[model samples]
Target chain A: MDFTAILGAWIAVGLTLFILSFLYRDNPLFKIAENLYIGIAIGYIFSITIYNVWIPKIYQPVSNRVFTSLSNWVPWVSKFVTPAGDAGSLTPLFPAIIGISLLTRIFPKISWISRYGFAFIVGYGAGLAIPATVATMFIAQIEGTIQPVFKLASGGAIDLSGPALWTSFSAILLCLGVIVTLFYFFFSLEHGKISKKVTKIGIYFLMVYFGAAFGTTVMGRFALLYGRFFDLYTYRTSGYYHATPILILLVLIFFFVYFGKSRKTSP
Target chain B: MKNGKIAAAVLAAIFFASVSGASAEKKKIEIPPLEGLTARDMPYDMGAAALLEWKIRDCDNQDMTYRIFVSSLAGTGPALRSFTEAGWIKVDEFKGNERLAKDIELPFWAWNASKNIHAVKVSLDNFFGKIQDGSVYYFKVMTLRGKQISESPVVPGAVKGNWFNLSRFNNLFYVILISMAFFWAVTHAKKGNLFIRRITGLDAVEEAIGRATEMGKPVYYLTGRLGMGSMSTIAATFILGEISKRIATYDTQLKVPHTEPVTMTVCQEIVKQAYSEAGRQDAYREDINFYVTDDQFAYTAAVDGMMTREKPAACFYMGYYYAESLLLTEIGSHTGAIQIAGTDAEHQLPFFFITCDYTLIGEELYAAGAYLSKDPVLVGTLRGQDIGKVFAMAVILLGAIGLTLAHVRGWDGLTRVIGNLFNSF
Candidate 1:
């Protein structure tokens, strides 16, 4: 095996053991591991943001295409421009200008400029999300409720047959229940008695839904635990000699705790 | 001498008889080979799945491992050659890194080479590495022995592709939703404003403790099984510190039974600190907070028993709960005690709504400590969370409008542009 593969395997084993230290009790070793995890995750996020967002969205566009095109068309512009200039260089400068305004928030005197960047981003995001939410969450849910329950026995079209009719009736009832319940939360004024009663019933339905959701959350948690157990068992039985690492780590933890206490007392 | 000789003789005869009896019990019979291999479309869910089942050989061990192989109709040699060649493209090549047993679900993409393929092979590996992939793959499976392969592999039966990739857009939507929530939370956190949070359940905590003190009874608190992720523990810590001061002044009892050892230790420290602050440290008992079992159901059952026996005036169910929520709540209800429950577990909210006097919903649990302590850090984080929610709602709204308008106008380019903008966030 290559060095990378061997090193990766060892790191996985070490992390597993580090996390498992909680089974004994939380200690400095676990704290160290936890801090290390936070540090690595933060580092990864920064790197990815730079690579995926900053570079492609800002630097590369300006330095390559825009500046090159601009300098080629206006050779005299090269004398005034930095080496980073490209074709249509002024096009990329717009985003940089906005970015600089965002950074201005750090300076007390120029903080007002930052509001422009915030307004643009917030406006753009709000404009994109509002319609999608209405279409998917509101419109689609309503449409689903209105779905016809009856089908023709002959497989041609709607049959007003007994089973089909009953199904359609139930569907209508469900749709009505959800709509009235939503109306219950319309807080323009103290709800009328009928609205209050409808809302109370709606609350019951909400509870039932919430209960099911809780069960799902529990199952997800159990799935994570099961995945961890699977990893432990697989490594153990596959002759990976996982026990030695666990044992060594435990000893080291005990020693650290002992030494920490002793130093505290001595000093 | 005669006695010793007789004893030895008897022992030998008993050993001989037992050995013979064991041998006589062993049965030998001819076992049938595997038959009727079939693959059919899996239904009622995603379409990209298929079910594979087989009638096992009579000699198959319950723990026996099965290796399934698929080949094209062209020939076994060609199929094996293709499979070997396409090794790099397989998504789950790493699954073979360790030993696996029993039925395996092979993805449709694994057999990409001839669309119309013939014959599947299955091998039982324990005994003689019985190659059952093709009934005629020049390999036979016997109990524990095999002969050298001297004949060509077999080719059998035609199969069709019955798989498709399921709902790529839906998966993308889910990823976007999660990332948006996380990003919004983080972004708002970076700002120094305290997030506004509504928690009606927390409003009742002081009253509940006061009622217990007035009634001259103890307040019982049980943190759920989740050791660290237990928001209940955090809530319990903050709430208990407040309650402990009242308890010290009123001289009422407070009992906390914890399932996790670490939580038990933390609870002790919190209670002691609270009492010390209240100038009633002498009244504090460390034993009041103690470890139970790590087993989920067992811990709940024990807590139920404690509630019945002690009959505390007030019981707090805070944190994560699973199947035991109903049982605990019902027991607490039966005891005629005031029950206040708070959990983010949406499934258990219904039970709490019916049984408990007050219930904390999702995000409300996180806000409880902040509500009680009014710590700037906690308040700030909560404010951040609210901002995130608002941000998320805005994004959802805008995306919906853009997509709808694009669809209505039959502007595919516009739709792509809008979709890309949504993704960039």
Candidate 2:
């Protein structure tokens, strides 16, 4: 392999190992990796948001839309195209002001200015979420819930009831599950014997749902673990030099600890 | 200039000749018409999507691939040529009888009643930028083989940009009805009409802290990686306030490693206020509740390190979480801490349930504070949510019974009518 590719691969393997080292015990290697990742992520976000979001969405559009170049929102492609001269509109300044005010929180004397930004964000977000949540979650869920239990025959008569009996049973069970689950959270009524029975059934659904979710989560976590292990295995199985960084970094960490402890000579 | 124009003409001639194949000079290919061509506005959306559909009549062979073209105005080939220049803007290209993703939003075609077919629908938003809502547009599906092409009859269509989409009216009804229920409950909360069953997960908040005090180690509570504006983080702050007060009374330390500066500031104030209220204001430490980076996984890694090194007696994870939920919870488990977690994030709750001493699933996380303090506003909202649940259960029960009966009785008309009503925009 070429030097750049090999070097990049080695660095990735090193970081992965460092992070995975936490499973053994928390140490300096994991600390360094965690800090590096955080630093890189912070820098990456700042740069990306500046070029991709603020410059295109706010700065360019508002500075003068007539000359605003709205091309290549991604940084990798930087060609520019300006809006037509008739695009002069200052409506974008309102949000720009709110964006700028958020930075004022850094200064204690003028930190109150940040509250305006927060208020705008919270108010606007709450207002937007009302319709969005209503439409996407509430209305959509209800619509999805109301459906035909079985596919009908061409003659429109309940054709072949024997085959479809299980389906009808399952549909009824699903409805019961929904009702009992809803009853599980009801605070108005005390859990008497009947309510307790209903809530118990509801808990069964909740547990089943949680179990399914947990099963999915286990697979997801495994997929991630597999990805990290894949990288370490991919590199080490290839050649001796690829495993050089892994061995050296690990040895160096222990080397410092061993020598430092011996030099202290407290014993 | 003369040479350039000549070269351009030559290029154009070659393009057309190549598109139609060598047979274009002699006998033109007699392309057959497309079957069951139709178009409609995509429902339950923000008027930027239109579903154009057609059957592949000529897909019996491997010679052709289909292409879909769109036009805002019809009978304007010259302008269309200027826009695309090569010909039509090919929105899609598919070989053979490859079917598109099926959409339940569209009504079943009358022609397809006899046979099962791949029902493909395309949304305009995917192909084009926000085209004006309610503006009339045109579509044509073309078939191409060996430079030969067949164009379907142009069909006119428009997406309706609406102030409020009627497709999700049921959801709005639910929201309003639920909100009203909450308002009613809040108004009557003092009257002692609402009866909330005990939540064991919430009750353990005190016990978790007490365990930390006995172990003589710090109690760690990090609201997941979310901004101050998020509802989960806001709720987390509320629960953190209660936890802080309880810990303060015991003179036990509370560590809050916040990701957002603003959230940290709010949390600091909340914890300080809680400590002050508990009459142990002097015991509260400002450094214990400090700012951490906003990078999600990085923050998670930092917390993992803390959990491993410090071995906090109790680790309380509350608020929103993503993949890091597993990392935090796994580390907490290994550290042998009494981990009490609560979150509305359903995906993370399962992991927490399997790992933590006690877990609050979904709405129970939100209800934790109300369950603890019996605050009228919080309790009222919880009660209100229960009423909303009742409405949902009633509707689901009735709908299921009716649909099942109709299916069992073979009443296809009722099925179609009600199904269409529920599914319609």
Candidate 3:
């Protein structure tokens, strides 16, 4: 690796160690790394939105159509004139105005103007979401749940083999799970004896689902933790100049000194 | 200029001789016509396409391929036409023995073609000029082997827009039934005739707020990383409005950190209006709702820092969340804060259920607003949703029994019709 790449690896190693120091306690190093993370993320997102969204969608089209059109009388502006396909229309002005109106919330006198933008968003969002939800989530889920239950043999008889019977049992269990889960969340009536029993079974199903999900999530977190530790291990090699071990030593000393003084001063 | 003209004339003569020679070479091999070629309008679609099928039982050559040609001429019956003709367009080409009828997504009730034949859907709108609906279109298939080609007889099919897709009848029925239920419930709710069962999580909101007020620590509320377009965020805002009103009445500090700008803007108005409703507008601070960065982990880190520093007495996590759910809730639990979380994101539920003092699962998150406020409209909507669930359960039960019986009895017709009714087009 080049000198700059090695330096970058060193910095990355130091920062990772600083962040991992939170496992010890919240110290100055952890706070520094946390603030740097937030600051860098804000800068990255702002630049991305400006270049990928605002400049292409708003500034370019408006400047091409409006500014390039003025180049007929002023010749120097012709240098920036775009093709006819892009410069022929002013259709982007309305959304730009609405976008600007959303920023008016900062000004106390005109803050109410932002409501027009929010109202448009909510109204359009609901209009698009309702039919899609019904088609995909509500209707399609019901269709998938109510499946054909039996497998037919080649001669048109019911198959009663072990695998086929297991599939049929699974289908019935799924149907029962769906109905009982729906009962558990039914808000209209109080639960009587039968309803209570059914909902209790539903709660058991929910707990199993939660347990499986928790195991997978914890496994995923461990994999991410392993990735960070492996990086730190690799950086401890001589080519990276022992950046991990040295930085860790310095952090340990700082922690000891910082806590030692505070302990001596306390009652 | 004279020399350039002479070079161009010599090149043209060579190209003409090569074209004639190539045609002669192609005529040396004899390939038979593709048999049983047919074209018909594809069902249950706005008429922009035609489904073409043909038999290919004997070809084993790996290099052989089929080419489809279409024309807008109305009555060009059965005779082979030159593809270089004015209206003909080569729409598609693929290897033989591919694109079987089974590969197509047509419903079983409408399409009963055997799985053995090759099928392709030709979109008429893709031709050079727009092919108008209600006009006749002709299609032909060509089989090619090395330098030789054999053309099938031309077949005609009309294109027309379908008024309705018969496959989505069950969807329409379910929507109409639920809408009528909502209207009926709304009318009855006006007379205070609706009952919503108790949700333990909502009952604890008051106690949590009272604890925060007595301790004189701020109550932190987080609307998760989704925009106003999501139903979960909207429900979260409703619950925020109710919570903020109670906090306003109690004269406790409330801080709402947001990950989406539009949601932050909406929740600002909600909290302001809430405080105004409780006759404590002076107690509401404009900075109660503030924008954090839109980046998920950055927002999580900033909020984690705040939670660690202030150690708020209570934390309310609502709306949709992703991986940051665990990071935020784990810190809240460590701070010894009373945390109540409500979300419809199923994957994130396990984290919240383990960390929070109370958690409202899937639909309960949506119904919490009605349960807390006891508002007629919201309560009516909740009851309507419950009735819709009943409708769904009844269908599931009856459909399961009917499908089982139909399968055991080998009733193919009933199975197809019922299956097609529930299938999405």
The number of the candidate with the highest TM-score is 3
Off by over 4 Å in 2: A66-89, A134-139, A142-163, A237-240, A244-249, A252-267, B1-161, B213-216, B228-231, B248-251, B260-269, B272-289, B408-425
Best by lDDT: 3
lDDT of 2 by residue, B285-307 (tens): 87868866778888888788887
Predicted chain B of candidate 3, TM-score versus the true chain B: 0.73
DockQ winner between 1 and 3, please give it.
3
Q: Over all chains combined, what TM-score does candidate 2 have?
A: 0.75
Q: iRMS values in order, in angstroms?
A: 13.4, 2.8, 1.7
lDDT of 1 by residue, B98-165 (tens): 22212232322222222222122232232223222222222211222122111123323322233442
**lDDT tens per residue, model 3, A76-125:** 77786544545545788888888789999889899889999989887877
Candidate 1 docking band: incorrect
Instruction: Kindly provide the TM-score of model 3 when superposed on the true structure, using C-alpha atoms.
Output: 0.83
Better of 1 and 2 by TM-score: 2
Q: How many residue pairs clash in model 3?
A: 0
Per-candidate clash tally: 40, 2, 0
| Fnat of all models, as shown | 0.06, 0.61, 0.65
Candidate 1 chain B, poorest ten consecutive residues by summed lDDT: B88-97
Listed in order, each prediction's TM-score against the native is 0.39, 0.75, 0.83
Candidates sorted by TM-score, descending order?
A: 3, 2, 1
Question: Which has the better DockQ: candidate 2, or candidate 3?
Answer: 3
